[model samples]
Target chain A: MKILVCISNVPDTTTKVKFTDNNTKFDANGVQWVINPWDELALTRALELKDNAANGITAVSVIHVGNASSEPTIRKALAIGADDAYRVNAEPTDAYNVAGQISEIVKSEKFDIVFCGIESSDFNGSTVGSMVAEFLDYPSVSAVSGLNIENGQTVITREIDGGKEVVSVPAPFVAIVQKGIAKEPRIAAMRGIMQARTKAIKVSEPVAIDSLTEIVTFELPQPRAKCKMVDAENPKQLIELLMNEAKVI
Target chain B: MSVLVFTENWDGKFKKSSFELASYATKVAEMLGTTATAVSIGNVDDSELKSLGNYGVKKVMCVKNDSLNVHDSQTYTKVIAEAAQKEGAKVIIIANNNTGKALAPRLSVRLKAAIGSGVNKLPLSVNPFVVVKRAYSGNAYAQVALKSDIKIITLAQNSFELIETPNDAAVEAFAPSIDASMVKTQLKDVQKQSGKILITDAEIVVSGGRGMKSADNWAPLSELANLLGAATACSRPVSDEGWRPHDEHTGQTGKIIAPNLYIAIGISGATQHIAGVSSSKFIVAINSDKDAPIFEAAQYGIVGDAAKVLPQLVEAVKELKGK
Candidate 1:
């Protein structure tokens, strides 16, 4: 069984977000690109499943839809333990277009399972996984926190409004995972890094798909007001201010 | 053409989010010079369905299918798509909650419509179909223009206010053809955490971080949360350290919450942590360091050790509430 984990190249979590070109584009200058945090966790969980011989997982592969600049981030996934990688050479304009590219890859590779992070930290569209499932007519389980292959059957656990539900989905399904899928993202070992240098990263041309949404502009959130300080000696005064001035208590 | 709103009910009862969706859809319909129609699934009461009229829905299409009683996203998408086609809806609106997140993308694929997910406002231009949504984890906003005849939007939770524009809404039963093949996933078991306010559903949140010192020091924070009837949350480091459950962690990689009031106790507010909570209406920070990054995002700050301050704040709230 092969698992295809979708990877997204995103700015480091600590980079201060900015916009350029009259706020029509994200300012990429001085930004450190990394694997999206959620995707990293998903890759870690996929590798963990592959490590256990009981699961009979043959390979864990990673795929991304982006330009050449994103190849480094894709290499990081391989270093962490993806057996191979696929880079759909194109700019991910929107979720629909990206999902289209991924669906094409899934069809060609016939991966038994596909894993996608619930949402990427950059756009936070939260749509590609389900869209890919629809494109492939495959079963999808969203908000998945736990997944295991038991007796050759895939068992999944997902979060609902106020509870958690255990589910069972057939093969060739998509799992939109969030946090708790793994304890922590696995770091690349020196040996894995060396091996990744020789791993094949097949660059494929993207299928033709028109992006449905266009970004007109971008704007930064309003700056917060100066904080009103309350002395530690008079903690009650803070409550009074909350009740009267802030009216949020 | 009408604006279609998908309203979700919890065991025959409607929640604030449904009303908010109805209100938002109605306003969008008005902007388009059309009426708003709502489609409700599962076993909702007639009176409950009628209550949507208070939020300006002109009609309600109730789908009483037991197979859809449990939310299968594929089946729900099919049902909603059928309804949208029946009504000839030019625009569709749903809440950007868990269910909507799962359903919208599939619906978009099935209906051949463009989606603007997690939009916080009404369209800036109806003709061009431009909507604004928070991007980059609320650090920036994007003005997205949808280029499709039918547009689907998932409204951000707590972004729109509930407006009461009472109308005598007509209720009609809708039965779309659902097949067994559409039920792709089966729910095996469910576990609910009872008698505790979930952080996502809470109006106020009191969050702790490493500055709380240790797991033993969480008592005062929990006590303050109980006193304010708020939920308890933690930073990622706290959850990673096993001081709190993973579900209690709120950050970019964790649960993203937008409560009315968020109190940060001993958190220094990394950019990722702020991303999850920057949407809160008001933030209060209590930390020993006056220059903690959390203060820059907080409206109120108390520069003191959480150990010395949390108990006093709890007492003050109790005294104010006469508890």
Candidate 2:
């Protein structure tokens, strides 16, 4: 089975977020980027699917929709055992454009299964995978915690409000993964890292898609005010302060 | 002008977040001087869809298709886009759960609409449109304006009140064209974790941290949460240590939650941790340490070991419920 996993390069979770150019864009200086946490789930699942297949799964291709700065992330994904990699040579500015680029590529390849993280940790938009599936006119599922594929069919389980729901669909679908989908992702091994150097890294120019939205300015979120701690012995004191000072109750 | 809302359903029933979206769409309709209509998705019966009229939906459209039994984001977007266009909808509202998050962006592209996700309130208009949204993992809010004619907004979970009406609404069946070839990814098998309420839509949450000491001692927390019909959650340290699943982690780098009531047991609220549940309406902290940071955010705090305080509080609630 041919599987395509879409990944994004994001700042490490511990990095303190900061914006540059007068707070109009995210500052990329002196920041270590890692494969987004959600994307890791997708990659791990794809690798697992490949491992269990008898015909020796053809390839687990990794695709990143970003500019030159994202190359290191794509390389890291390769080191983690993706068969090959592709970097769409463009700076993704909006969701529409991102989805359009993925759709343009998929029109030719026709991957049997496409997987992405539930949402990106940085933008947290959670829209691109679904948009890509919609643009491609393919089936899609989101925030799936568990998945299995057999006999040209896939079964997925996801959480709902009070409980869980199990759903089934045929192959050539899109699935966005979340936690509990698999065990903590395995770290890249030495052999995998060495083999990634010889693997193909395909570069593709993004197709032109109409851009309908733009971010005028990206500003830092307001800092929270200093916290006021009340003595724990007296619950009444805290309630009084909440009603009078915070006025939340 | 009329607004179109997508009521996401699972297992022949509507999701709670969909109800919150229903209430929010109604208020938006009230502002725009129009009525709100709902399109219920999934394997939902007409009767359950009609009951949504209590939340200000005047009409509910159920799309009955066997192919739609499982949520294919592509199919749902196509169907909802057609419904909105057919009804000449000015605004489209959906819940910002996993499905809505994926559906809205795609729908925006399909319908040529301006899209906003994680919205916390109705639009503020003054010759233009602006929506309030939670950003920076709920530590702050942003007001964004749209310049597009067609507008799509996804309401944040538990952000709006669920309003009820005295009468039932009307229901209608709609047919959606499907491209059988569009079905690509097939679902395989599901592993269900035994639990009470799913964390995302829970109104009340009971969470624990490293204070619980061991994984085997989680029964008390589950027992307490079961009593309140609450969802169970944990801090990052607990989840990182494999005491609980990562989905249950609540912190800045974890799942952000805003429930009506939050009970923190034996937790010292780190900055990352507080960023997640700071929006909770009422907070109750129980810790042995008098200076635990959780006390600062809690509405009511008790300086006692959680092992002792939890049982007492559970008994108190059980008595209050006459159980």
Candidate 3:
């Protein structure tokens, strides 16, 4: 079975977000870039399936829809055990454009299964995976926590609001995955890092799809009020503040 | 052109958020100088769909199919797209909840419409159609512009108030051309059962992170939640380590919650976790680390061990409530 994992480059969780160009663009000056946490989990899960010889998994390839600047982030994914890489050169202006690019590529390179993090950390749109499935005319599942595929058929478990829902589908489908798919993401080893340095990153021209949305401006969240520290010894003071000052009780 | 609202119903009952979304959509319709229409999907009763008139819906369209009882994002997308086309809708508003997350993107692509998902408020300017959205895990905000004539906006939960202006909304059955191949997926099994309030609806939430130290230490947090009539949640690590149930996990990959009061115990407040709860009306953090990131977002904080502090906090709340 061949697997495809979609990767996104996002600012580290600790980075302080700022907007430049008169508050109209994401300022990437001092921000540290890393693979999105959700995508990392997706890649790790694919590797685990490959390691265990699940479904005769032969190869795991990675894809990213961004310009050459995202090469480092793609390299990190390759280091995590992706067999090949493709960087669709584009700005990824919106989820629709991103899905269109992937779908265009999928028509040429057919894979048995496709995996992507449920949402991107930067935009948190949570729509790209399903849109890709629609563009490819493939059945897709969202926020799948557990997955099992066998002989061209798949059964997946996903979380509903209050409980879990288990569903069955045929192969050649998309699964947007989250936490329970893998306990811990695998770290790159020395040998894998060396291999990734020489791995060929194929840059494919982006297919033009009209982007419907744009970020016109950006603003930081309003500064939170300073914390009112309560004496640990006098625990009742905390309750009093919640009652009188905050009035949440 | 009219404004179309997708008023979703869960199970057999309508969610309060759906009503709030309907009201929000009505306001958007007023902003656009048009009428607000609603489409009710799933196993909802016709009476409940009509009740949206109380939320300012003027006309309601009912889409019924035995196969639609289970939520299929693809089919729902087709249904909503057809409804929007039938009504000549210029603006389509949906709930930015789980269902919206699933259906909105596909609909956006299908209709070739620009979308503003997870919008915090009404349009800032309707001419170009700009809306404010949460960015970078709620630490920042972004103004989005949708240039398309047909626009879709998914309003954030708890951000918009549910306003009632009874108009006796009329319900009519509408059929969208659908083929057997259109329904590509089906729900094999569903295990939804709720005893306590769902986190999305809870006014108060007591969330524990890895600082709780062990799975056994969760009792105090649960006890405190019980005392205050709140739900229990946890950080990603707590759930990842199998210390807490996965459903209780609240973070970036987990549930994004916006309760009235959110209390964090033992959580260090990673950006991922904070993104989910930052929109909460009030925040209080109880952690031994005085410099934990939770304190930055919290209005009140205590530097004490969660195990030692949870019980006392519970007792104090009970006493204050005269329970």
Candidate 4:
């Protein structure tokens, strides 16, 4: 079985996001780039499935749609135990185009399982995995928390509106995974780092697609109103404020 | 041409966010000097479909079929794309929820329309349309430009209040091209939450985090939630440690929610977690650490041990509500 995991390079969660070029582009200065946390979670799950001997997984590959600047991010995925890497050198203009490009590679390659983050951290589109599934005309499940692969069938458990839904599908389906896919993402060991340096990163041209939405300007949310801090020692006062003042209770 | 709103309906009624989108679409339509039409799918009752009139939609077009019952992005995109073509809609609206997350991107690709997800405010200028959207979780906003003639928007929950405009809405039956091949995957079974209100639909939420100490300690917080008729949620760490159900995890990668009142207990307010509830109308944080980042987003805060604070607050609420 072969697994394909898609990763997005995004600014670290701690970074203060700012837009430049008259708010048309993201300001990259002093921003620390890292593997999108959501995608890293997916990668962790993909690696776990690949490592389990019973799954009979052969290759676990990571794919990205970004230009040269994202190479380091792809290498990081390789260090995290991806067998190989592929970069569709292009800007992910929008979720539609991103899904379109991913469908191109997934169709050409015969991977048994395709995994992507539920959404990219930067745009938070939450659209690519399902869109790619639609583009590929493949069975797709979104926001799955638990996955088990056995006997050529993958069973996924996803949280629904009120409860859990369990669905089983054969190989060759797209899974858009969210947090808790793995407890903790595995960090690269020195040995793994050395191995990743030699692993091949195949850079491929992107499928042609037009971007739909464009950023016109960027602004900060209105500053939060000053918080009313009450005496923690007095819980009765807290309750009073919640009722008569806040009207929450 | 009309402003088309895709109400991702379920059993019989439209979801809360989709209902909000329907109301938003009507207001937008009135501004653009056109009518608002709501497009929906699944097994829906005639009266339930007609109730959209209360939200100001002029017409409702519903596609009924068993095969389209399950959440299929491909089929949903096809269904909505067909509706957009039929109505000659220039602006399409949807909710930035699970259904919209799956359908909008594929629909945009199918219709070659400009797509904006997490949209909040109305269009600033009509000539070159610009819509406000949240970014970096919820710390900032960006004005997105829709360059295409067919502009699609997925509005964030709580962004627009669903006020009754009162219109005599008409329901029309629609049947999109659905083949057997459309059912790519089958849902074996669903164990949905019953009896209790879901956090996604709750107006008030009381959430606990690692500060709650353990799963057993969730009792007091749960009591407070029950007293207020609110839903319960947890921070990522609490869910990761099995202190809470995965469905109750509210964070960037988990569930993004926007209730009227979000009471966060024991959470330090991580950036990703804040993104989930930042759109909330009011936030109240309780933590032992005064410097917890959650206080920044919270409208009210209490620096104390949740174990001590929760019971007292619960007692106070019980007294106020005269329970």
Q: What share of the true interface contacts does each candidate keep?
A: 0.81, 0.28, 0.72, 0.72
In CAPRI terms, where does candidate 4 land? medium
Q: In candidate 4, which residue ranges exceed 4 Å CA deviation? A: A169-171, A244-249
Q: How close is candidate 4 to the true structure, as a TM-score?
A: 0.95
Candidate 3 achieves a global lDDT of 0.85
| Alpha-carbon runs more than 4 Å astray in model 2 | A20-23, A53-55, A151-153, A216-249, B9-16, B42-55, B64-70, B126-128, B139-147, B163-171, B177-195, B223-229, B236-255, B268-278, B282-304, B315-323
Instruction: Give the DockQ of candidate 4.
Output: 0.65
Which docking band does candidate 3 fall into?
A: medium
Task: Write down the lDDT that model 4 would get.
Answer: 0.84
Can you give the lDDT of residue A158 in candidate 2? 72
For residues B223-245, write the lDDT of model 3, one tens digit per residue: 88888889999998888898988
Q: Could you say which candidate leads in DockQ?
A: 1
lDDT of 3 at A236: 83
Instruction: List model 2 lDDT by residue over B32-121, tens digit each.
Output: 888899997667877788878879899888888877765567767888998998788989998887678768977987887777777777
Candidate 1 Cα errors over 4 Å, as ranges: none
Candidate order by DockQ, decreasing, is: 1, 3, 4, 2
Error of 1 at A135 (Å): 0.8
lDDT of 4 at B100: 75
Residue range B1-323, candidate 4, lDDT tens digits: 98999887656767667768878998888778998999978888888888888899999998988888677666778889999999999999988776677677777777778788888878887668788877877767778888888988888887788878887899999988887577666677787656888888898999999999889998899899999999999999888898888788898877889888999999999988998899998899999998999999998899999999999998888877898
